[model samples]
Target chain A: MNIRELILNPDNFFKDLSSKESSLTTPFLIVLALSVLNSIYTYYETSIIFNLFPPDMQSKMSIIMIFSIVSSFIGGFISWLLIAGVMHLISMAFKGEGPFKRTLGFIGYGFLPNLIGSLITILVGYYFLSNAQVPTLTMEQLQNPTVAEEVISSIIPKTMVYTNLLINIAVILWNLGLWTYGIKYARDLELKKAFIVALIPVVLFLIYQIYGVIKML
Target chain B: MKKLLIFILFLFFLLLINPINAVEFTGIDYKNEYLEPGKTYDLWVIITPEKEINNTVIGVSPYGVGSEYIQIIKGRDYEGNLLQSEKGVGHFIIHIKEDAPSKDYNILAYCNYTKDGKKYSDNRIFEIPIRGKPTLTVENPSVINEGINRIYIKIKNKGTGIAQNIKIKFEEGNNIYALSEGYIKYLKPGKTGTVEIKVYGENSGIAKLPYTLTYSNPYNDLQLVDKRETESRKSKTITYNYKNQKTVEESGNLIFKIIPNDAIDLNVKDCSFPVGKVNNFTLSIKNNYKDSKFTVIIGKYYIGNNQKTLSINYGEIKNITFNIKVEEMGVKEIPVRIIFGGNEIERNISVNIIGKVDLVLTGVNVEGITEKTITGDLSNIGTDKAKSVLISVKKTERVIPLRPYENYFIGTLNPDDYGSFELHAKVINETDSIPIVIQYRDENNNLIKIEKNISIKNLINPNQSQENNDYIPLIIGILFIVGVLFLLYWNFFKKNKKIIIKNNKNNREV
Candidate 1:
């Protein structure tokens, strides 16, 4: 389904998608595109954090950034599968019937909003990081908790974090709505059960995100 | 037998007549036994009268042996009344001619009187000796200008007698002075005797020294002759030439040319000093006369051998140096006195004292949270103005200089004046102070640098624990995030829930 149909008419889009046989091509392509964007965002953020490290340590950060970008790229697809698998398991408890492949495909389509969100977040983050006043730190200074905390806060300001948070919440809510309809149609479950199934993981992820934001303060 | 009787009776009558004479010659006395030419003497004749006589006369006259040289001016004859047994005295004035012969002479004393209308006469003779006159002349008189000069004055006896105990008294002039009088023991006829005189002169020009020459005359007594006299024995003038001895002339009174003690011109060639510090002062002097010794005095108080001795020759220039310390600033005039050739010359040397510049930091203010900017006022507390003032932050292990304001230029600061400066630096952790360098030029264009430590204790870092209390931005960010979350849930979740209910109702109605 097109991005407009997926966003504006998620119920009809998911209903029409469940009628076709499950294919991994379109869903994998969407997930791969989102993973690439996520990897790019991750590379940008990792580079900023690595800049605070000492010169000798910064050389090693390049390798760590490569691994982190790879993990982020792989984690995007894994997260889509994990969300689908978890939702399918929860739907089964509600006496739902659905194949795992269809659930996975529908969950991957739900990540379109995340793809757009990552692009917007990268743009916003690029603006902030480009103009940010970053403090140079030695290994010894970086070890100091107060200096590290201040450095982190300076690099990622409260406004940028909050803005990113609002954007993430909006994207997550849209994904949740799409995922609820996708789960209901793909697993042949009732709307309430599908909504409950999708809301559980999303609510847990939201709580985790809120806890990180609070910890940053 | 009659002729013998008559001679006897005549002798008896002569004795009787001598006893009855009006006046009888007794003796002749002269005041000066030795007569000199061109001089006068006094002579007296005495007579005794046995009876009173009227119109009795007494007289004295030169008779034999060089008598032509002496002339009796008065008492040639005397007419007066004489009493019995009274001594009649006759006074005579005699003058010896300038060309008189030096020999013995005799004079006659006679008395004539009338007794009982008849005339009778009595006479006596005395011898007198004449002495030669003395004439003096000065010769070979000379003087010099350096120090105490010994003037050799040759006194010649031009007369035919001996000049004894000759004394030459020197009179001081405007530029010449006599240290001692000149003296000669004896000078015979046609003989010359030298007298030494000590004198000094103050200037290099013609000078006259008037003197009086005193010597014993032909009678072995003192006689004085000054420059005013026209005789050959009068004191002569000795003219001396300081630069050229050939110019000396023996004319008029005692005249001499002298080289001035102040003939040397003193000039301050170069004077350099700093206030409150010892420095060398130099004086250049040019001597215009003969070689002479000089005592040079620079200032009132001696710093380092202010009094110096120099021996300079004619047409020579010499430099003298003195170490002096001046405590006050600006131009100062020092008096210099040169003592030479028994004279002193005073001069003034102008010395300009350059003041020292003392630039100090008055107040400092450290600004900015992370990147510190130091702003402070610099004051010139010394006696001079400081120019091209610059303030810079010194980089250390913990202090790093920042751009744009790492160094500040303050232009100029006068004495007792101040200027402001600003410098930027980054002080690392636990560094409570940073070093700053202040540099400027004095009035003499000497570059001076001063290093001072500025305390950075007041510099607050944003990462500090105290600054962590400022959580307003974090709180605002959290509140905004929460509001956005609420709005997202209300718009998306509630709308989705209503749509789901509507769909479920549609399914139930179908």
Candidate 2:
């Protein structure tokens, strides 16, 4: 499916893609491309995110950036296979039939919303955080949780953080809607069954992201 | 009647001719009249008679003046007959007591004898004086020079009495000649006087200038008025002890000390040179006397100058350099003789000629963790050049050197030239410093090894955060995000009309 069709009507896009046999390379490449874009945004985000952290923790930016790249590339491939396997099993339980490759390709294409959302989030982060000042922290100051939180809040603009978080949550919901249609068409299953299959990992990931944000705050 | 006249005439003539009728008092004398307190003296009384005498008696007395000072032994009362016409002599032993006052006393002696049926008597008197003994001391004895040395002699009269008319005389030995008789006219008690006399000596040795002093006791003149007065004389010999009488030699108090240029431990700092190579050795000459000048003679082969004139102060040390070369590989001792003011002292120092190479490590910096590089400047601190210079990190039980590239070959390092090298090493927990070994070849192609240790404690334990990598959780979060994206793509993006149906035994795509 073309980018326009995938963006405007992801359900028909998945339906058109299901007629042809899916290649693992294309799905793998698609996931890798999206993951690489996401990792690039993360690399810059990590640099800004750690600006509110202490200096000692900030030096881990390089290691963290490298891990983002490696994990996204390798983790993308592994997750594609895992998602396809899980969906095929779920659809089979519901008396639905589809090739695992087609399901994987359809799931891979479903990353369109996230890819677009991450680009918008990066742009928004740059706009708000361009002139923002990083806070200076010491090991002693960071050890005291109250002082660390106070310092981080003072340094990171509240509007910028809130705006970035809202954009990320809105983009995630949009991707979930697209994922439900894409799964139904790709797996030849009911909308509810396809929704459960896509929502499980997304909910789990949302909970994890919220947990990391809380811990950092 | 004629015969009776003849007998009377003959007897009168015999009386006139008989020496017994001429029994006259001679004189009284003592062996030592100037007697010291608490000493003895022998007093002799003599008389002459013409004829034989019987029952003769000689008596001596101090006339009550010396009765307490002098104790004279008396003659017996029943003395036998004395010889006729022989000079009659009597000896009296007299002892002067310790409590006797220092003064002169008169001594009297009397003699009674019968000759030709006639009796005669005579008396003699003399005086004796008691005084303190005189002491003569020689002061400022000096060395006697060759050929008539005018030695200035000083004598001190350390006594209560005057040394009257003290005449000193030096003995002329085989090796010495006296030009003037040493004499002192008079010296009052507790007074010192100097008398210079000329003497000669042929050699440089401790020569004994034996001298005698003859002095008369000034109080020896008798205080008696009736008897004869005389003086008592005494003689004493004195020897002078003068050490450090260093006679003339070719080099006087000039000492030589030969050493290498480094003037440290003689054995360790000995200079070395390759065969036929020139090197420098330092020779120091010291004068141990006050204000002395000397000409030191070291041959031209050892040093450039045959002789050097050095005017050094007392205990002054001076140094000179000797440029010497030798052909054979052996140790040679060079003797340096220093001469000054007729005296000399010699010293010998050795120079070694053999192949040698020594390495010194400087400016060492070892940094990093287990995989660390040992970087330092290696210098050749020996007299010879080191070839095939190799610097390596030696492995020990606590340290393991990296394989394949552990050593650096520097090729050659001359004396005092420095080169830098680096080697990789890994240290275990037990190791604190790693030993950097340097191996090289000497001029004779002999392998020499040197090792230096560099501490890595500060390098390894840098003042940084020792925290474990926190990227594991971040990696997990990233994987989860990627997993979610993959799932969304699997469920919604791609379309598949034909679905594979799976039965209990077979699965088919329709």
For model 2, give the TM-score of chain B.
0.27
Q: How much of the real interface does each model capture, measured as fnat? A: 0.04, 0.00
Docking class of 1: incorrect
lDDT tens per residue, model 2, A71-110: 7667756866775667667677777676666777777776
Model 2: per-residue Cα lDDT at residue B110: 72
Candidate 1 residue-wise lDDT, B1-510, digit = tens: 999999999999989866544466777765444667778877778888878766777777779655678787875667677888788888888887777767777777788887667788877777777777668888634334545666677788877567777787766666778888777777877788887778786666776777777776545422222223233566555432223111112223576656554477777766656677777787888987567898998764348577999898888999988888888877888988777766565566778888768888887776443467678799988878899999999988888889998999999999899999888887675576889998888776889899999875533332343234434434543554455466446545776798889999999999
Please report the candidate that would top lDDT against the real structure: 1
DockQ top scorer: 1
Worst 10 contiguous positions by lDDT, candidate 2 chain B: B245-254
Best by TM-score: 1
- DockQ of candidate 1 compared with the true complex: 0.04
lDDT of 2: 0.62
